[model samples]
Target: MCLNLKKGAIFVADSHFSEVNVEFLSFLEKLKKKEIETSQLFLMGDMFDFISGESRYFVKINQKLIDIINELSHNIEIIYLEGNHDYNLQKLFPKLKVYKRESQPIFAKYENKTIALAHGDIYTPKGYDIYCKIIRNSALLIFLNFIDFNYWLSKKIYNKLIKKSICSKMKDFDSFAKKRLSYYNSDIVVEGHFHQGKHYEEKNKLYVNIPSLCCNKKYTIFDGKFITTQL
Candidate 1:
């Protein structure tokens, strides 16, 4: 039976570009086939590896993304949570949906339950790191964006650091998940960034740390009445 999200569902952020295709494609196709697009698509952050106005490939790629949105816009709703990577996209794609952090704290209620969702970068114990913070700051991002060579170099370093962060220099997402859950007192805590796809019942509470759209598949399925699974 097809299950629609009665009170809406959320897809936590982070795109990481190429990582999106392989794993999540099958699941997205499944969601399409299931006629279950009632869930809202919330992109928490880093929707791109880098946004390059000068790169023809980057422009084409974003256009394809826009096409994907147009195709799914009706069946599903979309909201893009502003991330450090998406800063440049505003110039090229001004109309894309974006949210201000102070204005965030979007809600999704299901089966008389509610949860707050975000990229969860600020909440991470080591959250965003020193370099990440510097680059994400408005002034530096603007300066780097205006310079093609600088943007390219910055992209290379950013990818390299992100890889390192994902691999070695990190604490377990479960601990982070639990910590965030403590602040909620709600039914669930949905976060993305650690790229760790996990969710379950513990201590009478639900903690969900969504996996990245990069490489391995990750998505949370919420039927109108219940959460089908976290895949």
Candidate 2:
């Protein structure tokens, strides 16, 4: 399906929400209270540090933000593109539009532009590709869910992720991005996961790397162009 990119659409990427980082929660609260308003919301990816629909422990921990999002979905349009840290979300978010990693680079139309949206993990090295597939495999997730003991494994993973550093500036990002952009066939390519929040243009094609909301306290609004703003 080709999504129509509306004016004032809000896009949030890599919030990495956990007990330690509650910035995303507060942002959601503002949206819920109508302090911030938008007709469309795009959850680019990794909105949580570690979340899976099959994991009951993870669900229990992140229920507050989940609930608010589900409630908001009733009145507005929300598209959630699953990232490395969060996936298998179709069940957990029945009301919202959920797109898994494989189904990404979804096409959208904005004025005369054909935009490609993804979680930004595609066209990776072979080793990383295998790792992503293994991690996102439903069979593996089910097996882990079956073996989890009192949520011990889940807690360990969450604790580790909450403490890890995820922000950095890439060396020669322009060159790196150009290589990636070569793989896309769109007027604009938008993605999250790199945490760089860069905007680049080469040969008339625009590449937007949304900033990590957790690291930058920033989110994006799409009007005629992509706008990054602090919360």
- The local distance difference test score of model 1 is 0.54
Report the C-alpha displacement of residue 166, candidate 2, in angstroms.
0.8
Structural similarity to truth (TM-score) of each candidate: 0.65, 0.97
Worst 10 residues of 1 by lDDT: 1-10
Regions more than 4 Å wrong, model 2: none
Please provide, for model 1 over 1-231, each residue's C-alpha lDDT reduced to its tens digit, 9 standing for 90 to 100.
112225556564455654323333444455567644555666666556654443444555456554555456566666665555554344454444555443344556665667666566654345446655565466665565467564475557555745643422236656756777777656766666666666656686777666665534455554442242444
Model 1: number of backbone collisions: 1
Best by TM-score: 2
Model 2 TM-score, all chains together: 0.97
Model 2, 1-231: lDDT tens digits are 999999999999999998877889988999999998999999999999989888888999899888999999999899999999999998988988999888988999988989999999887789998899899888888889888889888888888887898888998889978977899999999999999988989989999999999889999998888999989
Clashes of each: 1, 0
The C-alpha lDDT values of all candidates are 0.54, 0.91
